[model samples]
Target: MSDEKNDKDRRGIQSVEVGGQLLRALAHHGHPMALKDLARAAGMAPAKAHPYLVSFGKLGLIEQDPASGRYGLGPLALQLGLIALQQTDPVRIATPMIAELAQRLGLTIGIAVWGTRGPTFVRLEESPAAIHVNMRHGTVASLTDTASGRLFGAYRPADEVRALFEQERLLGKLERPRLAPGTPAAPAPTSWKEFERALAEVRRHGMSRTEGAVVDGISAMSAPVFDHAGAMVLAVTAIGPSGALDTQWDGPVAQALRECADRITQRLGGRPPVPVRRAA
Candidate 1:
């Protein structure tokens, strides 16, 4: 019995491992594929791959489009992915990283998730030399007024974000406050078209920025964390005093935030969205 167990461990099933290549190929392509194309992508002959596809179809892991005869991930595959994401605690995965980032950058690091009301800060790591910023766990952010809020606004569904934005606007949440000392006053969007441009810029840069908008003398940058479905699930932001924090789009602090967000996304088996390109 011991010898049999050892043999099993040393030489796991090869057939199943080979079949996984087909699933991986489908995922990598990110679209439905013809049988021959899929087989080639999986590095197998069509005859060799068809059997596995049939088995996977029966298990509901992959489905064939009858009209086009293309194969794609099926309902069971989607369900499994969603279940995995549901069980994943993004905050738990991000806490230590944010703590380290705060210490390294000497800026307050925070994690925000889309809460019922708005972007809600769930975790915070205050730098030893951090200034007084009115933020903490459970603090809800303003959609048009904070980096984290704009990050979500940029990535979340348009209708939902718009509804919340209008709600906030009605409550006077969209008003831009007076700028902090020496902070340049960038105009906040006044119309829906202008708001879209702002969000598009956020998507283009893969981050968001705020200068004394949320709190006086405070500046911040935020980057998004996405899940495997290419949906944003969290936002990581860094905050510091206006002069102390560089707000350049590609500055060191912004780079660090983007990198940290990317790491967290990757840790959760997620993919970053492709950068939005300007019109040719």
Candidate 2:
């Protein structure tokens, strides 16, 4: 059996491995690269890398910008990544980490994934103290009123995020009259400008937080988890009564949440998006 395994390992192609290394280098850099740089990173000569890139471009695994002569992952690569993400259970992978976080912090932890209705809580680990907030598995968090939702809003595609905000607006209107006559309306972003500003902050810091926005006296912080293709797959959130779970982005709870999300992202072979720099 050992010899058969060794035979199988030794039976493969070298050129294919070299081509895959180029793809891996492009993926690791997470940006388009000039031919020379890409070849250097892959430890190959530009002359040698060009043919493989041409083949990959024909197959839709890579694309070269005509203007800049830079190479990046192509649409087919994105499609393959989405398909691969579908096969993995993000919630299952996040469960143990969330459980450990809950136990250590004495705060409820939840994993929310992008569902048809937006960011939906798929799993929850309750804190030892019975904190009474209405979150449960399958609860569709309000995109404009919760940390988990805003985390998704900040990281998800713009079209999807806009749709979620529109849906939330309609729902809010429908549910407004149900509130007690004098109850104060929830404070939410009132304009696209405000919403974009909030999302910008989330993007800059790689997390989001809310204080009493979803549930009175409740606080929550959430960080995004990415897949191998740099797509957001889920979010890890920490929630508790306001006094227990600090809502500040730099607090211990927020740091732990971000670290847990980062760990999950790394485990899934994902890279965070590279920040763009403007002219000085």
Candidate 3:
């Protein structure tokens, strides 16, 4: 497994490259990054990290501050990221799919994962036409107000869903998905009856279908991906401004979307788990 991983890393980018990249982030930001901070930034485990980074510092690719014991780039690491963006391929594979979906659906299509926080957008591809909708990739997504957010919140474990608010930056609102700017926001459903009603629609339908939740004139539907380990690693959805989507939930597109979601689940390696917990 390690050999295969090493080969894959070599094809794309190396951990040494990532460690060096992480070091530079600390240096540019001008701070002492904790071990966990570096690990999170590099998508690595702390137990397996320090030594690889220390080796870079030893080579002067990065330097560790004595007072903080944090690593920073020593010049070599900076030179590398400056030269890197030329080789990333995950985006390459994901982009074509997003573009195709957007073109066909006349909506913005995106793939996002359940990061430690919320749905962290991994890639976003837009249609090439003159008029279209789009969202930035690599940004955090929402858990409220947007079509995809409803799907995410519905599928997410009741425990981890709380993490979205742990930082309290949102003031009980969805952060990444800015519910439409002018549309009247749903007054916080004061009762579980209201909240669970919303979730029930999303889960049973597979794709989160909504109207006027984000913008007064938009509609959206999203499907959660069942992952290899039977975990929902991500969800993909297509959303568009008001007129683009209509009462089409029972139409061909909607059926295709359901199949797509299930196919994505199979591709990821599991079926969405049968509902386990009873209503409290």
Candidate 4:
């Protein structure tokens, strides 16, 4: 089966049993790196590691920073991330909560599990209010583009996350994080300070917002969801164009998102995932 093959390929690339070691190093380094740094920190020769990094990049599973040449996990890495979370009906478990969130906040809501390409909008619950702009089901948005992606992308592991930084060009890629016209461009977080600041806000607030991070006048925010076995960022999401919610309720909606995702973790019958420390 293709699934089995992707798994095998993934194991060969990551050696997941020991992959955490490489990820930890990336977290500490806190900047884009040249290939030399990846192997040194990963405890392997750059020559031996070069092929894998290149392979990962070719797969869009990882990328070399054009600005700095460091390799980090790509969007494909997030696609690979769901291997653990899909063990249960993660979407179903999050359903009632997401719907309640929709009803209460009067904004379209959903949960996006992280993947190599970015956050896949796996579920959507629209507000009953006739005024809502409809968001589609099964929409996949990039971590660089949407609130769902940011909530999840900002939380991805560093070794696996570096590739998620803004890419310079897309001449030979399998996918592109969906970009809407007129959205302000985000310079890839090229340093730990910037990456850490984003992650810190996500943690402290349990989410982040954009006036139009993805689309002009379209606002969104999200939280994180964990599965029982420590699959982090299982799903946390919210979205709407400007002026959808009562200004006062945005805070409560955010809290509800965090609370509901946490409760869903328990409902799904697994121990909550440990927070992977934000990369440097």
Candidate 5:
């Protein structure tokens, strides 16, 4: 009995090690690969690798192109990645960094996640000279009217953003008067073409900003946080009095906010999208 148990344990460890080698090889390549190449990368004979590939495919960890015979990570891999990202505490990971940024920049910082209602603040850090903006944890940002909302809209799927926009529009219509007494409403987009153009600009800049759009005297700049699958998982935003907050998308505050968002993305094993350079 003892000998049988020891043998089973040895086989289990060997199986895990072999499986890990295949996974590492696929990750190192960063793209779909032919079976021969994949086997070579894993230092295994093609015959030896085929059995493992079949098992991995069965388990949904790898998928093969029917026409090309190339293999890549599959749906289960993406699901696992998203699950891991969800398990990682964004607020816990961002709290200290945001606090440090607030102190260094003398601005209030907030981290928001895509909540059921909208982009909801999960963590906030206030500078000594912070302005009294009516924001807090769980406060849902307006999709059409705030920096954080635009950041989420720009980075997330078009379908999701469109749904949110329709929902907000319906709510506004039902609420009678949407804008307050002295507040001026932002001009509605004249067409879908115009709305997409604005979002494209936001994506190109990798951030968004709003001036007195949410609060009377407040301004904010926001950057997106992504997971390994390139999904926007959170947003990092800095808010302050309109006069103090730099609303320029390329300003120091914007750069700092983007950098902070990038750092958090790295912690979640995510890579930000590479910018495309125009050819001269």
Candidate 6:
């Protein structure tokens, strides 16, 4: 009985949904479309689609070209898109997801966005068994060595990342790594060549991982969240005590992190980029 009621609650107007398919097709194609092509893309007969287009045009949701008879999104659609973009907050949309993931995976989950300096944590959900780390909402992660930072380094503009790295280096921040007392000595400061390789690995796998790089005993994996323009708008990261977190690229934790990021991207009406491929 509950399931049936839920199903009924989830139902929406069928005609509205059908009409939306035309809008979706136009958006997907990203240009004006002929009546026949639009109807075929929307999987409706042209006659059936014509009435919907006429109604949409009347409402300012679509426009038809007088010279070519092509259909395109109208002023109302552009206004709606702009409004949606303004209200789309990746951190707010991702908070609940990361909270649930933190509970399920028994690790810490965080959302980071491009801050004034670099990738800065805006939301953090620490698990019950959380490790003793000194991270908070405003903590700016290291771009060269940390999983969260490397994610931005991988997907963000090259000049921007290079500037940040150069600044950190000049400040002596990247000269030496800080490691936990019992953790083995931190690896050498990353050279440009090494940094490029690290980011390439991240792009190839669609995520980034670091073990004992940021903190001696903590391991983390991060995935990028993109906006409608395919821009890397956020980075979702999961961290925990090193051995306990399963930091392997193909491990369950990494998979969960990527899935969570993908959900956030979809929520924003965004799409994740295809993984980078190496030349044969």
Best by lDDT: 1
Give the per-residue lDDT digits (tens) of candidate 4, residues 175-273.
322234343554433554665576666666656666565445667777677654665656666666567642222577667776787798766545544
Task: For candidate 1, give the lDDT of residue 86.
Answer: 83
Quote the lDDT for 140 in model 5.
81
Q: After superposition, how far is residue 129 of candidate 4 from its true place, in Å?
A: 3.3
> Highest TM-score, which number?
6
Instruction: State the displacement of the C-alpha of residue 175, model 1, in Å, after optimal TM-score superposition.
Output: 13
lDDT of 1 by residue, 1-280 (tens): 9999998889968999999999999988999999999999999999999999999999999999999999999999999888887898889999999999999999989899999998998999998794765556888888888899999999888888888877876676533323334444343447666777888889888899988776667898999999877889999998888998999997999999989999999878898765443321
Query: Which digits, one per residue and each the tens of the lDDT, describe model 6 over residues 125-240?
Result: 98779478777778888888788889998888777887887787666453222343454434445566678788888888989988887667778889899998888999989888
Between candidates 2 and 6, the TM-score winner = 6
* Global lDDT scores for all candidate models: 0.86, 0.83, 0.63, 0.62, 0.79, 0.85
166, model 4: CA deviation in Å?
4.8
- Poorly placed runs, candidate 1 (over 4 Å): 1-83, 174-189, 273-280
Quote the positional error of residue 119 for candidate 6 in Å: 2.0
Q: TM-scores of the models, in the given order?
A: 0.67, 0.66, 0.57, 0.56, 0.64, 0.82
Candidate with better TM-score, 4 vs 6: 6
Task: For residues 95-189, write the lDDT of model 5, one tens digit per residue.
Answer: 89999999988998988899888788888888679375556678788777778888887877677777787777666521111234545555443
Arrange candidates by lDDT, descending: 1, 6, 2, 5, 3, 4
Backbone clashes per model, in order? 0, 0, 4, 14, 0, 0
Off by over 4 Å in 2: 1-87, 173-185, 274-280
Give candidate 2's TM-score. 0.66
TM-score-better candidate, 1 vs 3:
1
| Model 5: number of backbone collisions | 0
Stretches of candidate 6 off by over 4 Å are: 1-14, 29-31, 40-43, 66-68, 174-188, 272-280
